[model samples]
Target chain A: MGNENRIVNGLLKLHIALCLLFIFAPIAGSFVFSLNSDRFPSLPLGEFSTEWYRLIWEDPLVWQGFANTVVVGLTVAVIATLLGFGGAYTDFRYNFTGKSFYLALAMLPPTIPVVIMGLAMLAFLSRVNLSGTTISVIIAHGVMCSPFAMAIIRLRLSQMDPDLEAASWNMGGNQWQTLRYVIIPFAKPAIFAALFITMAVSFDEFAVAWFVSGLNETLPVKILGFLQGQVSPRINAIGSLAFLSSMTLIILAQLLLRSPEDKKS
Target chain B: MKVNAEMEQQSEAIVKFDNVVKRFGNFTAVEKADFEIGRGEFLAIMGSSGCGKTTTLRMLAGLEDPTEGAIYLDGEKVNGKATWDRDTPMVWQSLALFPFLTVQENVEFALKMRGVGKEERRQRAEKWLEKMQITEFANRNINQLSGGQKQRVALARALVTEPKILLLDEPLSALDAHLKVRMQAVLSNLQKDLGITFVYVTHSMSEAFSMADRVVIMSRGQIEQIGTPEEIYREPYNRFVAEFLGSANIFDSVITGPSGSDGWKVDFEGGETSLSKDELPNAVQGQAVTFIVSAENMQLSAPDSGQPGILASVAGEEFIGGTAMVFLETETGHELKVQKSHDELSLLNLHAGSKVIVHWAPESCHILPGENL
Candidate 1:
């Protein structure tokens, strides 16, 4: 029995160590690279300093790109959530014609090649003379993020009891009233979850933004631009900061929207 | 209480279903059901599952629309109106309270939507919480309460709106047996004191019979019978109604002999019974028929002067609460149940395999012709 327990404990500790390494390896490597004075990322030894972090902050083009990314992420989150919510509500509540076809169409974004969607949008937008601006980038990001939002929110909506809405209606609530009072409140957690995930997707998206963004330079594209040179440690600083921002935002959103029982004591 | 009682009495019929028929694509749920509930009447729709009893209640509550009929509340046709417009509230089987909301907020939600003052809503909510014996749970989240406490909170929420009608869809079916009995009494007394129109749906006959002013029994999307509980139990219209309510002994027979102006002699299973034509209207000579007799009305041993009756052998004996059931197998291999008081059990001393003479008067048997039987 002692031998068995030792083996079991060893396996559990090994699994936890592997999990932590898998999560933090990339982050720690990027941080180390950002501080290394050696311009080449492959170099083993160099004088450590905060000069790269200062350079990242001083770059006006990087700040512009960061601002553009934030704006695009927020815009995409709102648009994708609205479209996904409409589609989910239609599929769940009503028996409209072509419901299955619409649902299938809604699922195309996550499965299709991002480059292909980006190329298709580019061709479509160029013909309409709307390529490369904030509108085009916003539309492309919204389309790319909607399927993920729909998937998350639909999961939450499906778990809800339909009778609760019926009870609201029986209590003298109209369709709008029932939606506002019962359905929306029950779906708030799902909406927040979808929002955070969509923001992450839009903020980190590169391939599609590379094609659709003409004049608008999001942070990811700017980082890609920096990679054309001799491995700038300033780019490493930017990557580390972006990773930290995403982790904090996601954890905060999850904490805010957790079920009542999971809230703090 | 007196002022509220007078107001309820003066209120008109709260809900009326006029031949409502609800069908799903090819299947019918409620087939032309008709009923009216007066104000402040605690009516129960009772049947086994899939009997359209719940569908009927849903129609009245406006949770569902009838495919082939109209519903009226306060003399207004509300067939197309949404549930919220009907001014009726529902207590669900799952107690569909907002889990995130405090008990007070959940109960006051409808009032808030109606634009009632915040202070007034809280005050009225406190009143309903007290009435439902849940005042201490007023500020707690719904998930924090126990099952019975949650049920009371849900009831308080539904009643706090003071809607013209309150619909309950199997609200107590999920409770444990002990809690069910307790809540049943609580609901019964609460409805009486509040004097609000209650349209309750349930599959349990005991639950329906205990509190309903009138019970509607449904079977296969049709109303089987509608009457007071006593009338329904005492005089069931057909075999389905009789069997669904509880127990009844059904016997197949064919009329044989007849009397001049008095009664006829019916032969059944090697025994002839002298039953008046008035007692057996469809008992034509040489015609098939069935007779129904309640178990409690059956006598174990006949008096020496009574008519000759069928002999039944005790197949099984069971002692119930304050009564005993003697399962009797007739000579023709049919089972007939006879219920007797505990004191009467000592006289009969019934056991399995015991031969007992089962007897009943002509008036006790409800005779049905073969076709209707």
Candidate 2:
């Protein structure tokens, strides 16, 4: 029995190590490759240089892509968080007819293929003369990211004691007040989580933005364009920089949203 | 006497229910609940689960509106009023203290929603926190508090609003037995000091008996009886109330003779017993009836000890420190529970298969209308 237990533990540790290597090796490689002075990004004895970083920093196209990414990411984050919080709160607190169907509809976009969802939104938006615009790209990204926000928000809402909302109402808090005070306060961590995931997803969103944005190219689309047109060390520099910023944002988001109870520990 | 006094106080009731029938879909949660809660009345709605005691409290709190009839508060028709507009607050069974908010913030929430100035709200919250004896913990988040402290925070939150009526739904049910007793004292004292009406809903007779000024006993969503705790214990209206209250031994009985100047003899399960005219004022010969004998009132004598009593064998015994519950099976196959002090049971030397005699005074047993179990 002891031998079997040891073997099982050993295998589990090996599996974990392999998974970590699979995820981080490429990111680490890209970081190292971006620094290698060789134009072809090759082997051992190469002088580390900041040429690619400085090149991308001086490139106007790269700067435009970065600016577009921030704009689209921020817009998608705010809109998706609001939509997701409202959807989750209503689902948790109400008992009206057809509620199940509405929630299922809210979850439909994420469950279906993103390519199909993107194409469908493009077609529908075009019928309304809304396709191929910056706002359309923003809306499409919000749609792509909201399921994640809603899922986390729902998990948090379900963990909440429903009696608190009832207590609020019983204490002379109107519906809006209860939502503003009790429900929103309880949902703060989840809302921040929504923002973090939505922002990340929107920044990285490619298929939907590529299909929907006719003129306004998002950062990922513009990068894809650059890569398709010509491969450069500048791409690696941009990728590494984006990875650093995303990780920083994720960590900062987590610290800001940490529960008071968790902070005690 | 209590009923008359309550009747006089009804005209000035702070809250009144008029033929209220609340239903959820096809199920009726509260059936024709008609009662008046006087100013500063500590009323308790009590029953087992799904008996609609909590549903009644919810309706009064305006969380659940009555599907039929109207509810009036302070003589204003409030049937369509939202929960917040009613100025009624509730302490939930789970406490439901805002886990993220600090203790003072949770208490100050109602004041904040009411647009009270920040300084005033803080001062009021601090005053309540101090009165609840949780002042030191006011700055701490809710999850950091103990169960007793959480209960106090819930109380402070509900009371800080200073509403005319405060509703509580089994507030002490989650506490440990010892803590429940102590919180009961704290809540009762708080209600008295505040002079605010508290409609407490609980399933525990001890809680209602110890804290409530009057209790409404319910069964299957209908009011069984409403009276003082002493009145309820001494005069339960039906078999349900008697059994639900606790430790009652009941038997089927039939009137055996016409009324005389003294009393009437009735054929009980195994033996004949006489009930006073006062005990069964409307009973006639051969009419089936039901009667209740409390566990404590059941006197056990030895077989052929020269006292007239029903013969039964001791089936089991449970020793609960100060008192012991002696289980017996009568000749007619009826179960009788007799509770006596340990000393008394020891004197009788009660053991399984020991034959014993059970008897009670005519007036000690309350006669109720017969119903099939």
Candidate 3:
């Protein structure tokens, strides 16, 4: 029995390791090639160099794309988190007709095929004369990211004692006061987690931004442009930097998403 | 003069519910609840789950508006008042302390909502923390506290604003037995010291009996009985109260006729008994009646003692504190229980399957007033 259990556990561990390797190996390869002083990504590595990083650092267009990405990511994160908090709190506090339909509609944007979503966004934004702009990218990304934020905060709110809100009211706190003092404070960890995760989502989104951002391209769109233009190691360098930043945001979110007690000062 | 004083006291009740009815769609949660909570009274509304005790407490707190009547707080009708507008604070069953806030902040929440200045809120919250004997843990988060400590924080938070009436909905239900008793004492003392009316809702009989000045027993969305603990225990209003109490041997009897000038003969499943006029007033012949004899009042003896009592065989014995409860089944299969001290039980030398006679004094039997005989 012990030997059989050991075999099963060993297989499970090997499976997980294989899955992680499959996900991270490409990013790791790009990182390694980014440091190599090769013109093209060939297997026999040249001497380790930061030449690609230096090239991207001096490119004015690269800097512009990076700035646009940061602004769009930050603005989308705030807007999505606020909308998500409102949606989650409504689901928590009220019972109404078509609630499930409302939630499904709110969560529908992310499930659509990104290519189709990009085309649809382009069609809709251009009709409003807002296409090919950073605002259009922010709007498109915000639509796709808010659902993720809502889901995270909804799970956190579901774990809350429903009586907490009523207890606040019973203690002479009005609805607004209770929202400010009790509901928001209890969901602070998940709210911060939602913010980070949504920011990362906006930062890494490419297809929709590619369709909408004509002149003010985000980093991902700019990276795609560079890939189409030339097979340079600078693409690998930029990819490695973007992957590192996205992973950092995700890891920070994961840490914040731990049980609220552990996050206390 | 005494009647006038009593009338004056009734008018000065801190809270009153007049013909209050609460319905959730087709289900009635509370039906025509009419009661008044006197100033500084410790009133406990107790029943099993879904008995509308919590609903009643919520209505009093202005969390739920009465469906058809008015609820008055401080002699003013507050039927449509929101919970925040009422000065009624409730300690919830789940404690409901703000998990993200420190203990002091959780207590100050009510004061802050009331727009109290920061220094005053801090001082008021600190006073409660000190009173609850949790001053050292004031800076700690709520989740960092133990069950008993969390209970104290909940109490302090609810009482921080010093409302005229405080509500508690089974706040100690999650505690262990020992901690429950300790919190009960703490709550009892706090109510007395503050001189504030407390409307406590609970399902535990011991909790209701031990701390409440007046106990309202509810069943099926209706108030079955309301009195002091001793009054309800000694003379239950109906069969439901007797069974709910679970400390009595209830017997359904039919009034045979008048035994003499002032006594009536009654026939039960076990045998026959007679009751004086005072024991069962206004008895009618052929009328079905119900009476209860508390476990402690029951007497047991050997079968051959020639006692005028029901013949039964012992079913089981349960030791409860300094006393033992002897369970018996009569020839008619009626289950009876007798509670006695260990010394008395030892003298009887009773065991399972042993033949015994179960009897009680005629005066010990109290006829249920709500039997509708």
- Best candidate, TM-score: 3
Q: Model 2: residues >4 Å from true position, as ranges?
A: A253-265, B1-11, B369-373
Query: RMSD for each model, in Å, please?
Result: 4.2, 3.1, 2.4
Assess chain B of each prediction and give its TM-score: 0.89, 0.94, 0.95
Q: Show the colliding residue pairs in model 2.
A: none
List DockQ, one per candidate, in order: 0.62, 0.73, 0.77
Residue pairs in clash, model 3: none
Candidate 1 residues lying further than 4 Å off, grouped into runs, are A1-24, A42-44, A256-265, B1-14, B259-261, B279-283, B302-307, B346-349, B368-373
Model 3 agreement with the true structure over A77-111: per-residue lDDT tens digits: 99999999999999999999999999999999988
Best by lDDT: 3
TM-score of 2: 0.94
**Candidate 2: tens digits of C-alpha lDDT, residues B221-304:** 999999999988887778888888777887778888954677888888799777777766776788787878889999999886
Each candidate's TM vs. the true structure?
Answer: 0.91, 0.94, 0.95
Q: Rank the candidates by TM-score, best first.
A: 3, 2, 1
DockQ score for model 1: 0.62
Tens digits of per-residue lDDT for model 2 on A1-265? 9999999999999999999999999888889889988777667837889999999889887887788889989999999998898788888978888999999999877777878988999999999899988889888988877877888789889988888888788777888888888888778878887898789888877888889988788888887997998888777888898888788767766675565245344
lDDT (tens digit, per residue) of candidate 1 on B21-84: 8998999999988777888888999988998888887777777889988887876788878776
* lDDT of each candidate versus the true structure: 0.82, 0.86, 0.92
